[model samples]
Target: MTLKSPISIYDAQGLAFGILMASLGVTFLKAAALVTGQTAGAAVLLSYLLPLDFGVFFVLISLPFFWLSWVRRSASFTLRTITAVVGISVVSPLLGAFIRFETLPPFLAAILAGACSGVGLIALFRHGASAGGLGILALIVEERTGFRTGWFQMCFDAVIFALALLVLPLDGVLYSCIGAMVLNAIIGWNFRVAQAMPAQQVG
Candidate 1:
């Protein structure tokens, strides 16, 4: 494929995949009463604290980080992250309105949401893009420290979940932490698998 055409196609697919992942991530957060880290976690915390739409809050919180990504990372990475961010910002509320689970248990919700979010995250990373929250921060940390970003991300998520406990009930906080753990574990496994895969296979 020509450079222009291939890049265009990749962007389109990445956008779709990013939206799906982010939406599922949000769903998991809502269901399990969990938070990730950085912007998205901030958004979730703010939404719980204040009366605000999660999607709007998420985009507003991510703007500064988007600017930071542009300065710190490649233009392509910035562009891809921006696309994913916008897509998630737009789709999350719509998904929220359409999908309702009145009876699902919290643990099951956590497991399913974590799995879906993980799959979505793997798709975004494979496409040279991201879901643009803790994921971006993790990527940056991994590039700088050579320590596994997944573990770093988990630490941040744990802190956020801990703070969340102060705001929410103890049980809710516990479940949320569990959900975060599952999500981060999936992220760690996916990253290692990606690293293990041959360059030719990944390409």
Candidate 2:
């Protein structure tokens, strides 16, 4: 597919907003010492297995998926996805650098961060873009199967969480898994509401 730059103000705003939310989600995962699904999840998994920066790892893992979206979807979709991913890649580490909440409880941090991330993700999806990686896959699956996107994401997160147990302590894996579930729940709830609001208004 041919690629082109996004020109509209609405597209730019959507890309910016989506990226901001995704960055917050990544930051929350770091703060809670939790793992997620998609490229970010793979980044966390890689960080445990290798000596690499998670943010760099995130971008690297997302590249293939970005290309896939470019090929399968519109250039506009790819551009927005790339913008969001790059934004998250840059913002995640910066947030990690500037804000380290060591004293906060992991559960609380995970919930707050996951909720913020979910909202950001939904905003991105609603705007016709994605945060990359399994996010694209999740969207495709939801569209095809008519299953809830949140559940699709949760399944992916579970796989990653299981892999995490192989590398991390049992308790850490458990907390990460729980954190992922909470994040998925937040996304699912919001998605359902967004879906329903239109129908209700139409009625």
Candidate 3:
């Protein structure tokens, strides 16, 4: 699509598919007892500590970032992000019911989860939306500083992994690192911040 083109029904379908793939990645991580990074990681960590589902924590934690998104991006972008966040929050939980991984290896789960999430994020970026949380920050930083969004997220993932250590097994955290690397590498190498979307209606 050209920079001048408007968002169409096809774009909506793409956004929906992106959300589904991202939610599937989350399901993989949850099944393997591994948390990658970003708001999804925080939601998973919180879900482990509390008595709620990942969906509840995912939406609740992402709420504050909406304001940040509004200030940094556009209203449309912010709305798209909110919708995407809610969509993942709703879909991810239901996935456990339908698609259960009886004995998923954490190492394998990490690779699959990272691949799914990376491609899914590319789709969202193309549509001028994100999964909320640090994703918004990553985009803003990239736009302003010419920094790669994936690298920016990798820095944040460091802190999340450190915290994960306290809550998760050492081996699990190590495997999670592999997933985070794969996720960031895909984004850093593929999605350039400047050409992420069109200036017109990508958001």
Which pairs clash in the backbone of model 3?
Answer: none
lDDT tens digits, residue span 1-203, model 2: 54544456876786688788777777777776777775688897787678887878888888888777766666766777777888888887888788777486767766766777787888777766778898877766665566777888897787787778887778767767766777788778777423522221111
lDDT values for all models: 0.68, 0.73, 0.88
TM-score, every prediction:
0.84, 0.85, 0.94
Q: For residues 1-203, could you state the per-residue lDDT of candidate 1 as single tens digits?
A: 11122456765785687578768778767755666555677777888888887777887877777666666665566676777777777777777778787776777776666677667666666666666766776776776676665677778876777677778888766766666677678878767533632232211
lDDT score, candidate 2: 0.73
Please give the TM-score that candidate 3 achieves against the real structure: 0.94
Error of 2 at 105 (Å): 0.9
Q: Pick the candidate with the highest TM-score.
A: 3
Q: Which candidate is the best by lDDT?
A: 3
Question: Which should have the higher lDDT, number 1 or number 2?
Answer: 2
Model 1 lDDT, residue 52, Cα? 88
lDDT of 3 at 100: 71
Native RMSD of candidate 2 (Å): 4.5
Over 4 Å off in model 3, which ranges?
Answer: 1-7, 201-203
